[model samples]
Target: MNELNPLDRIRELCEQRKWSYYQLSKASGIPYSTLNTMLNKENMPSLPTLQKLCQGFGISIVEFFEPDRNLQGLTKDQALCLSLFTSLSQEEQQLALAYLKGLSRTL
Candidate 1:
């Protein structure tokens, strides 16, 4: 798979969260206007800006650079589900698993 530009990564991260550029600005503490102009351009964001973006995505820089979904072979839904599942309590996790199994039986 071709690599995404850093700016592309930022855009992809925002898209995955169903976030508007404004939401990213709020989460990253960057100005919305700045992000809007920067993300639309070819210029790479500065390291500090990148850091803020990573923080907004709740991922490390290393994870940021990891292979994206095309290479990782996870569909968008699976990736989102995994992320949400990991954030749940153990009891909630068990409940979700049971729910999935029950749903599958009805399918």
Candidate 2:
């Protein structure tokens, strides 16, 4: 696997979401100053910090580091749903799944 720069990956994810660093800081529960200093100095984040970032990005650490995989099988709507679901907090995700289960049961 090619070595990827974590900072560049973070920037790419932010660009994909059209998010500012402040937005990321809020989502990741990271302080803006720490994030800014890390990026400005090109310092690598420790594992826990990286985990917070991955959580904020709605992805796993494996997904964050892995090369992009083909997602062509998903329809646009399905992909959108997945993206929205991933962005939710853990509790919200569980609630969403329960709601979907309830809806499915009515069918």
Candidate 3:
């Protein structure tokens, strides 16, 4: 699926939640005019702004980064594992895979 820009995602969230820009701003403690400008002009939020939005919506940074689906659907441990896996060097990846296979054999 194509990814929506951050502002587009925020706009969609607001519409789905039946929230006005002012309501979102109030909820997020972001300035109403800034939120309005972002939504109206399709401007991307800064990292701090995105963080505030996620916090206001009772969500995590991973959730905000996932444009296609809700992050709440994934367990915290699963997300953490995935993050760690994706960051591994190629050699480290091979080592981890081998370790897992060895553990599986023992079990």
Candidate 1 lDDT over residue span 1-107, tens digit each: 76758988887777656678997888788999899999777768999998997876667787788734333778888877877764454456689999999999999
- Residue 10 of model 3 has an lDDT of 78
Which ranges of candidate 2 are over 4 A from the true structure?
A: 70-107
Model 3 lDDT tens row, 11-83:
7666655667787787689999998888778778899999888766555777666742543568998766655
> Model 2: what TM-score?
0.68
Error of 3 at 10 (Å): 0.3
TM-score of each: 0.63, 0.68, 0.58
What is candidate 2's lDDT per residue for 1-107, written digit by digit as tens? 57989999998888767778888898899999999999889999999999999888778898788734434588888878876775565567889999999999999
Worst lDDT run of 10 residues, candidate 1, spans 84-93
Sorted by lDDT (best first), the order is 2, 1, 3
* Residue 75 local lDDT, model 1: 81
The positional error of residue 59 in candidate 2, measured at the CA in angstroms, is 0.7
Task: Write down the lDDT that model 3 would get.
Answer: 0.72
Best by TM-score: 2
